[model samples]
Target: MRKTHLLGYAGFSGIFIFAISILLLHGRQPEISIRYDAMSYYVYGQLGWLLWAGLLGLGLGSLALAAGLWRIQKGAYARVGILCAGIWGTGLLIAAIFPTDPKGSWDQPPSTRGMIHFSAAIFAFIAITLAALFIAHAFIKDGHWKPVQKWIVPVTALTAISFILIMISIVSIFVSHGAPLYFGLTERLFFFMSLCWIGIASVGLLRSER
Candidate 1:
């Protein structure tokens, strides 16, 4: 619970995720991604590095999140954990659309993004479960509050609503024709929401020090 330990561990995790995501994406992922074709190769060659960097940000953000959760109330941690898992897990559900198709043969390439997304979901789920256990430990915590209603209720609702959006895209992928891009804005939004939540949590944890 010491400020230095909380911040230090969280900060280290944040940096580790950020760095590894980048290295995995650029140092290795693009080569695997490029076997699709000349065009696909060109695109990956150019932007795969960038996407890797973005994933890096997500990883670091998660660390900050884990650290914050370690400090916050058990209920708050659970809320944030679900928020994170639901967000990142949605990415896997989206990416699942790939790894298939007539134009892109089965031999095309491998995408670690989906795997990475899956791992994040599992981690977030575990974190939340632990938070829940902590919640059951003797009840000195606040019972309920209106501000939680104003923020947690609304944000959780938004996350739930977004699930419908994800379902639509899933149906569309099976029912519709084609895609102009590797991914879509909706997937990005999922991660973005997760990032916003963790980033907010990190700030709150940091601020609590004042």
Candidate 2:
């Protein structure tokens, strides 16, 4: 198979593994509320290894997509997009290495490891959002990617909006003093949108001529 095709398959496989891991984790850890608790909290559960695997899948998938796009795209915008995507992948890996504090522990001061994990998560989200924007812009300029631009641009917009909602939910949580504000839901939406964008781009790469 071609290199791009391999990368494309890797991207799909990684996402598939992550999705499966999430489903399994949810089923195994019934105590964890999907709506109120952050996904990172899963790391403290009995099926914590599943969460680690899921994070690794996401991190590897992102890196694979970035590699494939970097090989296809050129110029300043493309370069910047690729860099941001790389950062997103790196941040995910960092987050995986450093697990967040226990659930409800946010009420107290964050631990050093927890702070690192939170920072990595934030950086990953922001980097991926920028990656989608810049990459979509680069797609608009490339004839080979023009067809994908139509699909990716809308997903990118939704990703950005979801990210904003996530920020608001986080702020509400903080201001309300650990009150539940659907932060998990908003965060899931952002992650889902971002992953959708990555899947679309990976499919585009798969269909592109070598």
Candidate 3:
């Protein structure tokens, strides 16, 4: 397969993964002391495979458009989404490498797991917002945002709000000094927000392919 097509295929799968993530997070928060062992395993199940899949898409799309964006051309809008996707993928890899079992002692008070999760979220949010701003810039210049690309704006707005949300989540983590509830909500927010941007990108890419 051609590099673009391979990237697009992977991009398509990555978008699907993001969609699954949304489904994963679309519910009420589980109670405290309820270990996420099952969900954690599921998260690992998808995450372990999908991170690499996402990398292919992010790598190709970002490289293809980064130079153009530097010159203020189109598809610059995608650069941040690509960057955030790459960072989210990397963070998943890292978490998988050194995961904290939900019931583990470290998962309790002074949550090392929460810290790791929160920090990764901050990075991811920053990347998503940057990408969205640029994408919006491109979208505006061309006056070509379709119905699907329409999601990009709200997704970006959420991406920006997540910056604040993640910060509060982190602060709440610190204040509570490792409550599982705070940590859990943080994870849900971060994961779903990521899904939003990833889905937005997937929609754009698939539409482009069609």
Candidate 4:
């Protein structure tokens, strides 16, 4: 297979691994409530290494997709979009490196590691949202990418909405002093939508190469 195809497959496989990891982690630890608890909680439990591996997979996958897209797309928007995607991937790596504080630790002052993880997570979310928007705009401008625009545009819009919901959920949790506001659910929604967009883009890249 060509390098582009390899990258494209890598991107998709990375996401697939992450999705499977989430499922397995959730299944293995039934005590952790997926609705209220952050996915980071898994890091403190058994098989935490799997969580780390999953996150690394996601980060690497994102980077692979960004590199693949960069090779094919040539424009200011595409360049910026690829850059944002790279930032997102880097943020994921940082988060994986520095796991979030254990559950209930939030009531007390957060540790430096926890703060770094939180910041990286926030930065990654914002960066990926920007990536989706910018890349969608690039698709609109490029006839060759027009076919992708149809799928990406709506997915980007949903991704943005999901991101907004995540922010709102986070703010509400903070304001209410950790009252459960479905923060985990909102975050998962955002992740799913963003990953779906990435998957679509990666498939488009593969098709274009063909």
lDDT of candidate 3 over 64-162, digit per residue (tens) = 333323333335445554555455455554444444344444435536765575465456456655666556655544433465566767776776776
Point out the worst 10-residue segment of candidate 4 by lDDT: 140-149
Q: Which sequence of candidate numbers ranks them by TM-score, best first?
A: 4, 2, 3, 1
> What's model 1's lDDT at 88?
43
Give the TM-score comparing model 4 with the true structure, all chains together. 0.93
Q: lDDT of each structure? A: 0.41, 0.84, 0.48, 0.86
Off by over 4 Å in 3: 18-81, 104-122, 140-145
Worst 10 residues of 2 by lDDT: 140-149
Q: Which of 1 and 3 is ahead in TM-score? A: 3
Q: TM-score of each candidate?
A: 0.49, 0.93, 0.60, 0.93
**lDDT, candidate 1, at 90:** 39
Output the worst ten-in-a-row residue range by lDDT, candidate 3: 29-38
Comparing 1 and 2 on lDDT, the stronger one: 2
lDDT of 4 by residue, 40-97 (tens): 8898888988889988999999999899889888889878989999999999999999
Candidate 4 wrong stretches, greater than 4 Å: 140-149
For residues 99-139, could you state the per-residue lDDT of candidate 1 as single tens digits? 22223432344356534543544454344333223332212
